[model samples]
Target chain A: MSDALHDPGTGTPGPPATPVLSATGLTVRFGGRPALADVSLDFPRGRIVALIGPSGSGKTTLLRALCRMNELIPAAVTTGSVRFEGAELYAPEVDPAEVRRRIGVVLRESALFPGSIFHNVAFGPRASGFAGDLHALAEEVLAAVGLWAEVGGDLDLPASALSAGQRRRLCIARTLAVRPRVLLLDEPASALDPVAAARIESLIHSLAGDVAVVVATSDLRLAARVSDVTAHLDRGELVECGPTGTVFTNPRSKRTEAYLTGRIP
Target chain B: MTPLATRDLLGTACRLGAALTLTAAIALLGVLLVQALGVVDVGFLAGAPSRFASRAGVGPAIAGTLWLAVLTAALSFPVGIGAAVYFEEYAPRNRLAGLAGSALANMAGVPPVVFGVAGLALFVRGMGLGPTILAAGLTLAMLALPTVLVTSRTALREVPRGVRDAASALGATRWQVIRRQVLPAAGPGIVTGLTLALTRTVGAAAPLLVLGAPAFVTHAPRTPGDILTALPTQAFTWSTRTEADFAALAAGTAVTLLVLLLTVNLGALVLRRRLR
Candidate 1:
């Protein structure tokens, strides 16, 4: 089912082609109700792309579906193309475990294990048989997120002591430590104060030079600040896609304009 | 109404009621153990139970119960945890798996005596193994199966979904994720179930009787094929015997068994806290 649509979606015109991931006609239905219908977009390598939309506009659905997580939830069915590195992600017998490892996710809800913050960040690398010093890697990643300087001496402190914004960055550091080819973040900075939010935005910009980052958010202002290319989705369809500046400055669809003007959440 | 009076009404009543219930149950355990152990002799620890009512101890019986408890722990711990992992993390949430899961839990509630009969038919007689420690151990395993499984499953289920997700998200295979993340987080709970199951096996007599654990053995059975006597069966036998001395011997054995249970429960508790 996904094979036939890959050619057309993958070939869809985008500025200076060569996308790390090109999803096409990515349809997902939960008990015959389409949560995402024919949602196609491309994410170029080493670029920060944003998926912005209103509630129920298929932002998270598309993000999760791209990694083949629809199958994890009972009664969910995914069809069409979700290609990563030009490889069919939904191909039969392709291990979803492998797909997810290559495509790490920072969930909407922050979660840290019941252990020191060091264990939370080291969780990823340890799972992949990373025999290197986990504490060192944890320190490195935390330092990268500018957390080491603050919490460096207390590496053994419980994760429960961390503030909400710190937990968000720790989650990011955890994902980054795994060295995933693609990073999928769902509302990475939604709960943060302006200062923390700007730091996260800068982190996104810093991450763009190495990995393909796809940030799914309903916050148009955040999308404008973070992404190189922005795609606005409305009711499971890709309504508009362009450079972040062009799309927000002169949105083609009424839905995009409404979203930019705060008419839509 | 005064604020203090209002606060004291239902809340204090409910608190009193709950505390009384807990205290009553614990008191009941103490009374039963003390009564049952009264049959054991004072010198039983250093001596052995005998055919004559005048003789000293229930050493063989204590030994048999120890054997039974240890064997149950050894057999049920790994298998119960394996079953739990399969059901919680690996099994598809289909009708068949769900039914199997419920059936396993229901199996725990089966009568101990019935398990004894099955054990006799299958291991003691049908398998041609005759009365032996293996049959008795297998019988106890059947009886303890449900507690072990339910506890293990509950513990495994309590593990945060994010732990598994994070591991899989980081490219760990299902087995790897379970090994690295799920098992470590859930280990404390599994240990708890095992300790409870072990404690239960120490007191049960019906199934042990069916498996041919003798009422009394002057000498401890050396191997699985040898006939054995468990502490509970010996305590019951001694209490009914026409002798007052055997009663003291049974009391001592009862005390010893209670201590064993306490030790295990405390150890599991400590391990659980450490893990946490």
Candidate 2:
């Protein structure tokens, strides 16, 4: 157990690699009621972190805060610091748009634009002022998501024509087109069926090599299946954080144990 | 009566009421058409207004109305839609925003004649523009502005939040999200609103009258500053002359205005459908 803490499954480490994103004493209040309180965590590069909690446990708020999206809410007040690549995300000099560009957030509902599928995928690159070939970028991202074969020939079709699973992948492709370094997914599979959910889980696992992925989910089994690290949040507090296997089998906190065993209610 | 019989009775009453309303509308249009049919001709359409009612034509009035509609649309659409975008997308959700939104809603319901008086004060006397087509057009634009703003705000608000979030997630600036996603999604509604505003402006007689649009103009307006008479004003003038020929001419002018309005509305319908 002592050796397991040092061995993060990646063999070559004297110490853990510096996280791509880190939060220190992060607290968020919306109209003076706390949504998240004093959350401090690190998201390492090339890893999948699952944020599991019940509804209103601040899982989504924390994910949004990382990319400074919480600011979009009118009364959302955030204190403390979120650093992405060693720069404060909420710094006066930092642009939220730019931060979101580097750290893409994929919402549960497939939010495709009311345009052609090709345009939906190309939106990110075009908005980011990508000077490269837009068509090629769309093709590349679509292929990465394994959606090119189905949607490639019908690039002119409206995005609304896609099925649920296809729309979800198209959204992922949209995010990938911008070439983000960190990907935050809020319940990416909650709206999907089991087969589609499994596919999305595998997709998230596959994406770990390219970007640091944080998936906020209420599904504990999904967290156990896909995440390298699991963080349990309850009532706006981080109750436990550890390796996925250890946390599920041997939780440090009674709250986490009760939650896993269906005793929290 | 049994509950089932009561439901049937209510349904029958609703159907009868709808039928009556539709029939009344058709009957009124039929009367207007019968009155208008005799005076409408190529000669009446093409000839300029004259002292002789039989020789008078609606050509100048039609042209003036077209010019007013175009200028009013051009002036109002951009400004009104811009204001809507500001209120819906850019304005912070605060008391000031709430107050401004309420004020705009109230403006939409203000009497058209009040807008005419305002146009009279602001554009004619204040700007020294005289009672030219520009002043009339500006007055009609003011009348249309509130309708455009209110309806456009509704259109913009109809854009789904998820679509906006998707654009923002793609790193689009606030303006880019609105331009690329929100506006396009809201396009059909916006077009519908603009069509309604322009149609209302074209049918307006009071504001143009307040602006002192000429009852008779010799030539088609060549510029915004040219003196002009619109269709409603022309029809009103002809109706008041107490001559049977002039009354017939008024009905003809009304039919022409109706046709013009229908054409504009149909074009807008096609545009809105295409946007959808």
Instruction: Give the poorly placed runs of model 2, Cα more than 4 Å off.
Output: A1-16
Looking at model 1 chain B, report the run of 10 residues with the lowest lDDT sum.
B37-46
Cα lDDT, model 1, residue A204: 82
Enumerate residue pairs that collide in model 2. none
User: lDDT score, residue B243, model 2?
Assistant: 81
List model 2 lDDT by residue over B1-276, tens digit each. Answer: 999999999999999999999999999888778888899999888889999977899989998999999999999999999999999998988999989888987888888888989989999899999888899888888888889999999999988888888888888898899998899989999999999999988798888888888887879888998996889999999999988888889899999999999999999989988987
Clash numbers, per candidate: 15, 0
* Interface RMSD per candidate (angstroms): 2.0, 0.9
Chain B TM-score, one value per candidate, order as shown: 0.87, 0.97
Summarize candidate 2's per-residue lDDT along A168-255 as a digit string, tens digits: 9889989999988899999988868888888788889888978999999999888999999999998898999999999999999999
Model 1: how far residue B74 lies from native, Å: 1.8
Q: Model 2 — TM-score against the truth? A: 0.95
